[model samples]
Target chain A: EAGVTQSPRYAVLQEGQAVSFWCDPISGHDTLYWYQQPRDQGPQLLVYFRDEAVIDNSQLPSDRFSAVRPKGTNSTLKIQSAKQGDTATYLCASSFPGLGGHTNTGQLYFGEGSKLTVL
Target chain B: AQSVTQPDARVTVSEGASLQLRCKYSSSVTPYLFWYVQYPRQGLQLLLKYYSGDPVVQGVNGFEAEFSKSNSSFHLRKASVHWSDSAVYFCAVSIDNNRIFFGDGTQLVVKP
Candidate 1:
């Protein structure tokens, strides 16, 4: 099976510029996620969707970051007015909805990630 | 609220040596725990996971993790390390059917 796919593996932008990253999850996966991984840090959850409905985005930087999964298969995460601190790898992941409606217990499949650098 | 912690920032060991990476988590209830490995310029790959029963869980590439409820710990281990096994490892936690919380990560360097 093909794994999750992400476009623009590497991106470089200047401060105050904006960029959008795209993700195509594995077929039939109902849960799609976006994470930010700063250098030397683990992936931090930014947002997630379940069949086009956002499940959680409390950790997302609302002022500068936004994500959407319109068709529930592909997703886009956009960061507006990027800052130097926004330089980090943006990772996308997907998981089949857990059995018995337990979404918290499933294993996740991840993409190679899009590295964003804001200078 | 859920969070994970990996105390070791980096660890170095000779090839064929045994390996252990520590992880701790904070959660109100029983949370699902997972270990993932990320090689250079690659995405995180699941090494193993523990939900319940049998504190020790086996994973891909001869990796395993033992869950300790008392200490709120889930540490990854390998019987023998290979140079190819060198990578950054993360411990993650999740609760209430929500998003996963990740650790700061631990970088492992295996010397040949």
Candidate 2:
């Protein structure tokens, strides 16, 4: 089975510039997640969607970050007016809801990630 | 407050040595716990997961995790680690279904 795919494995932008990262989740997966991982740190949740409908975006920076899953298959994460602090790897993951036997343990499949650097 | 904590930022051990990576989570209720390994230039992969029952869960690559509700811990262990096991390991917690939170991660260095 083909895993989740993400484009632009790396991105470099100057402060105040903007960039967009794209993701195509695995087939038949309903839940998609976007996470930001700084250097030497674990990934932090930014936003998530369930079949084109956002489940939770509380952690997303409303002012600068935005994400959309239009067709419920592909997703796009855009950052406006990027700052140096925005330098981190953007990871995209997907999972089928109520998965992993009868327990629903929710195991995610991740992409290699798109590393973004804002200088 | 940090939901999940991996106190050890890095650990080094000789190849074929036993290995243990510590993980602790803060929650009133028992949540689903998972351990993920990130290899060089690769995405994070599931090593194992913990739900109810057994307390000890087996994972890929001869890895396993022991869940302790009283201690609020889920620590990953291996009988003997290979040099290929050198990577960053993360402990994660999932609550309210799929809402997940992750730890800072521990870097394991297995020297030959």
- Local distance difference test scores for all models: 0.92, 0.92
Clashes within 3 Å, all models in order: 0, 0
Q: Which candidate is the best by DockQ?
A: 1
Compared with the true structure, the alpha-carbon lDDT of candidate 1 equals: 0.92
Work out the TM-score per prediction.
0.97, 0.96
Model 1 ranges off by over 4 Å: A102-104
For all candidates, state DockQ relative to the true structure.
0.74, 0.69
lDDT of 1 by residue, B30-111 (tens): 8999998998877788899888899999999999999999999999999999999999999999885558888989999999
Q: Model 1 over residues A79-103: C-alpha lDDT tens digits?
A: 9999999999999999886667657
lDDT of 2 by residue, A6-76 (tens): 98999999999999999999998888999999999999999999889998899999999999999899999
In candidate 2 the C-alpha lDDT for residue B103 amounts to 97
In candidate 1, position A20 carries an lDDT of: 97
Candidate 2 ranges beyond 4 A from true positions:
A99-104
Model 1 chain A worst lDDT run, 10 consecutive residues: A97-106
